[model samples]
Target: MRNGLSVDVEDWFQVGAFERTIDRADWPALESRVEANCDAVLQIFADAGVTGTFFTLGWVAERFPALIKRIVAAGHELASHGYDHKRVFTLTAEEFAADLEKSRAILEDLGGVPVRGYRAPSFSIDARTPWAHPILAEQGYAYSSSVAPVVHDHYGWPQSPRTAWRPLSDSDLVEWPVATAHVAGRTLAAGGGGFMRLLPYRFTRWAIARMNEEGHPAILYFHPWEIDPGQPRVADAPLKSKIRHYSGLAAMAGKLKKLLDEFDWTRADALVPAQQERARPWRAAA
Candidate 1:
């Protein structure tokens, strides 16, 4: 799509799926791994001259301050991906607020940029937790990319707006849910996450193109772990988790290069104002 791309900057071992087997405390060496992986991502973006948002976990920013600074220096948007990988839906409103505030502070302090956007851990802000939106606004976030309008093993808001739309929670806060494609009666893969790794490259490109054709911006997201297949295995996870995270790791970089070549993408913040105005009926014809 001509819209934009947003990357979640965190390593694979940091994900919640590995929590049961490997607690965050157990993974000390993951720090160096994340730093190396993030640099690889920076090289990719640099080669393409692409400026995209990097929603970083507070933990990542805290340890890798130089990386966060490099992202801002490269003219990319810096948004929070929560303090840890804790799901917003699982936290009480106050707890969730704390996580968001902490993450915002950490990112801003490190990047010297105002962190106004958030993407929930695991894309967990679904219908059951509609309250999360209003809470996000109340906590001073300007936009959220936490919901995906597709069903998955962890999180999906099937009925949420597929395109960018202002939330009733507060006029300033917008909802830019993950892009989705219709297959039969179901919402199929649109952009990033496991779908980016699992689906064929052509399918992902087609889904994004369809969104642009419909006059919407596709928000593509990916994790650092998706590109690192050599990462230590989390054998404790159910068979499905293993397949989801590791299935196509080797091909991710090539697929991403093709994506950069095919789509006209940029950071979400750079496109936010126009996207917000475009959502207005009065501007639709313009």
Candidate 2:
């Protein structure tokens, strides 16, 4: 029951409030940062002998074909992350569908791979928009890692099943929620955003290992910005954003390397084989 890893490919400035400030016109400079950041991650994976899924924003794929090509060439799974980083709940079905198609087509063209998986920006899929699951299935996405089952001010579906499950909303879209730490009847999120940054590495390893024991492989995800301490700071960023994005940046790479060394990890798509039975119902859901 090896765990899985996924990286959401985006620049540091394009996150949260900065999204409002950093216009599409500013993307060229952002692309340079994206390259250096992703290069470091590629090196990290190479050193650890680990492979991971990279859910890239369509904006990045369209602008950086070479980067997308390099990711696929390196034997990692390529997946869509919507056209821009727009929240799914914020978009109408038509808008969401268009974005999904746009992102999928761009990724397929650039990566030269069957981009079967997707992850909502900011992990924003929740009960507020169950429509997203079916839309993803309709768009031919085979799996999703967008549900974070813990409560958060921004995005979380606390009552959502922690283990991978086929939502009634979509048979073809297997919902892979982020890893969590179950303690004394409470489920604590283990990885992603601030949780990955602030939490100790041992705790994450133990939580993920415990999840594997329960027959659910952990899915750990992060962004390139999380490892870049020198990233430009957003002015008047929300207190929560400060904590979630910048808390432990300097330590992230080392912690990530330790995690790679200690755990049995592989790309999310690799788990598709072992999770075939679990995901089979999803195929019908589509």
Highest TM-score among the candidates is held by which one? 1
- Report the Cα lDDT for candidate 2: 0.82
lDDT (CA) for every model shown? 0.80, 0.82
Candidate 1 local lDDT, 95-149, one digit each (tens): 8888888889999999998988899988888766756777887777778888777
Question: In model 1, how large is the Cα lDDT of residue 75?
Answer: 91
Q: Name the runs in model 2 displaced over 4 angstroms.
A: 20-32, 279-286
The reply for model 1, stretches above 4 Å from the true place, is: 29-32, 280-286
TM-score of each: 0.93, 0.91
Compared to the true structure, candidate 2 yields what TM-score? Answer: 0.91
- lDDT tens string, model 2, 1-286? 6789889998887776465556767767653577779989999999899999999999888877899999999999999888889988898888889999999999998888899989999888887786788888777777888888887777888877777777754354588887998899988989655677898777887888888788788899988878889887766776666676788999999889888888888999888655645753332212
- Backbone clash total, candidate 2: 6
Worst 10 residues of 1 by lDDT: 277-286
